[model samples]
Target: MFTIHAVDGYIETLYLAVYEDRVLLIDSGCRSDVPRIEEVMKRRLNRPMSQIALAVASHTHPDHAGGAPTLRKRHAIPVAAPKDINQWYAGFSGGLQHKIDIMLGHFVAWTLKYPFEMIYYKKHLLYDHPLKEGDRLPGFEDWQVIETPGHTSHDVVLYHAETQTLYAADVILKVGSGYRPPFPVSMKKEMRESIEKLRHLDVKHLLMAHGGPQQVTDFPAIVDAMLKEIDKGLPPGLKRFRKLERFSPVMKRYYRERRQAKKAS
Candidate 1:
């Protein structure tokens, strides 16, 4: 077992697990923060970089996988990621939109009192291979990959059926929680369906990518909340905003802030 290392103020986490002297690092932090990540690694592992056996990302989100290239460049470690995330990662091609995306990320971070580090990657640094649901990780045999889309079409969650533990990416959470982000566009129906799918799983300990892991009980209640929103529409709070048409201005402001964050970064 390895402790989750929170990355910078963004509240991102890097997973570290060891087998003998071999270490498995999951989802390195953003590119701008790699030095701090490496420093944290050295301090925690009390060993050099060569000990890392493999690195994996739940999806292609920069917050989750941005540091992969740096880690790979330094250690030549194989970076494994969901097969479906290539396009999303590649969507950040240099342009006005890239800046807008960066700004948007930063704005969200600011509102959350977290600073998002902009991620920059080399062309060759894109993932070299794809990982699919049900594919066994090289060193982690007991863990199974399960597709858990909602936040993103390519999102995935890791399930250890024997342990009844789930690394649920963005599909579930206990902290740093609330509304979903505005991008990848909202798929309220899909999100609700995904939540229903998860409710049926035998999950006990749920680990969200952005929050601390927690024991989940009353799974049906959470599933009901999701389904209710989907069948009826967004929650009351969101609905109130919509009825007053107050949500539009707030959403617009949020978008503007995001654009600004990108420029500042």
Candidate 2:
């Protein structure tokens, strides 16, 4: 039997899919979350660090892809992520945005009343495998990847057909009885389209990075609710962060490239 344990990460909930022999991290947590993951696997799972065979980064954001490289270095665990995941933080703007993302991670922590901690990590992503949509996670074939862009230029959610669980990364967030699209909605149209794609899936459970895990009676209703929030755009308190993020070089370039791609397609 495969048991999925939700580890309390520094900022987000870390999902660890464990088996008798090996383990898989549904979404690698923040950089500072490295030690925490290690501890959980050792003490809770009673497995050595090497048992963590693969760590998948569902997106390039700080809380999603931050701890992957370090986990690989520390335990030689292979890192897998979406195609072009690195491009989101590729050039000069990416560098600045990366630092800004680190600060934002801290800012998010602050907003959540989380005590201070180091959230820094290398700006660039280093993954052993580049996963395209529909590619089964390198070793864990039971899980399949679904391209769900919009929260960023590149985002993906893993779906387990048998279990009907969608590991929605930053693509969806549930906070205090509410569900909404991730911050910065870097690509609003795409985000909605991505959510639309998810709406069609037979997902009975949503495993979110932020909202812990949840059971679903009406998944489409939840998706529709989130899509509505996306359409409504950022609320008053979030408008500033959205503006700041959109002003970043990364977002500017993402916008230009998306515009051109739309025109071409």
Candidate 3:
């Protein structure tokens, strides 16, 4: 049996996938989340911290990777990240809005998790393993890494063929009554292409970083709807407003659902 734990953080969710005696942690939240992560591992999985054989950061965003260094140091786990994660960590080489969004994201994370340990806020983490397209992640049979860049230049999604599950980090998000990227998309084109790629996969369940698992009865339909929204692109101001309006409440519900889903699963 495979068990998944979703832990809510300041603005993101951390996922723990336990299969047999191995545990794979996906996306360490803010620095403040380490203690809770360790607790969950011990209490829920009945495993020591050292059993977290692998840790992966879906992207280089602070909400996703801020706690990686601390987790790595504390448990001596190898971190697998995109090869270009360092460049995105430094700062996305996009337009002015993209740069502004990156800065704003950092500010918000720091503000929400103030007095956090400074070591967790490092701009870049030293990845022990660098992943590329088509590579099978070690210790995960039938789980292939898919490079789904767009939300960030180094965003990746993991596809477990055996379970038909897609660990979609931030490539797709579920908002109120609809789905869209959260905010400040750097490359709309690449994002659309990534979604197209997912459309071809045999995905039955979507385990998103920002929401609970969704049964994909009609994934193509979902992708079509999302693409239609992408086709009618919203202006930057409107996009930001919509995102802000949905951020807190929607994420709160997602956190709750994530906990419930983990228990039920």
Candidate 4:
């Protein structure tokens, strides 16, 4: 049996699956997270850095993949990431509108929280192996990689049918008692389809990158809510505001405070 460790980071969580005196790291956190990750390895897992046989980046997002380059360079660990990561690694790709949307949402939000990390992401870090659906992760024979793109075109989720565990990555995020997609879903239709795929799975444990572990029972209602939103397309004004929320740190803080106040009330 492998032990799973959730290493908390600035705004992301890195998962480590340990088995047979070796570790498989999922999502390497940000640029500055290496030392903390090492600390977790030495103190918590009682393992050396060399025991990290393989590392997988759930997607190309900085929080998930920023430490990948360091892992590769320092530990010489092999990394498996989405093939399409190169498209957005350097910067944005696709149509002007698409680029603008992502820059306003994901890019701006990341920069607001981790400026130097963002710079490191764009300038450094080269993804190693390209993973896709049906690919079995090395050292984790039971866990099967499944494409779960929505947050990003390259997002993938890991499923272990024997254990009924789903390493959902950012596909399903825990919000209070329920789950939801992270803000500024770039491909709504694809995201919905991915959620539908997960809905059919006989998952008992739903593990996420951002939120820690969640109950599978909490997923159905969240999926239903997301499907309802997908059916009702975003209004132009609301879309604009969502993008603006990413760009303006003040707006983000205001919304956060407002939500907290509402919950308190």
Candidate of highest TM-score: 2
lDDT (Cα, tens digit) per residue for candidate 1, span 62-166: 566767888788878787778866544243232333344445446657877864466654422366557776877667766677776655566777777776777
114-209 per-residue lDDT for model 2 (tens digits): 999877888778889898888998889999989988877779899999888889988889988999888878878788888898888898888999
- Per residue, candidate 4 scores C-alpha lDDT tens digits across 155-187 of 898888887888888777765655557655656
Ranking by TM-score: 2, 3, 4, 1
The candidate with the higher TM-score, 2 or 4, is 2
Clash count, candidate 1: 5
Task: Spell out the clash pairs found in candidate 2.
Answer: none
Which regions of candidate 3 deviate over 4 angstroms? 91-103, 106-120, 235-265
- Candidate 1 residue spans exceeding 4 A from truth: 1-9, 89-99, 114-118, 122-125, 175-185, 226-265
- lDDT for model 3: 0.73
Task: Indicate whether candidate 2 or candidate 3 has the larger lDDT.
Answer: 2
Top-scoring candidate (lDDT): 2
State, as a TM-score between 0 and 1, how close model 3 is to the true structure. Answer: 0.79
- For model 2, the superposed segments whose C-alpha errors exceed 4 Å read 247-250, 257-265
What TM-score do all the candidates reach, one by one? 0.72, 0.94, 0.79, 0.77
Residue-wise C-alpha lDDT for candidate 3, range 215-250, written one tens digit per residue = 888888878987887777874656654443222222
CA lDDT for candidate 2: 0.86
Candidate with more favorable, higher lDDT: 1 or 4: 4
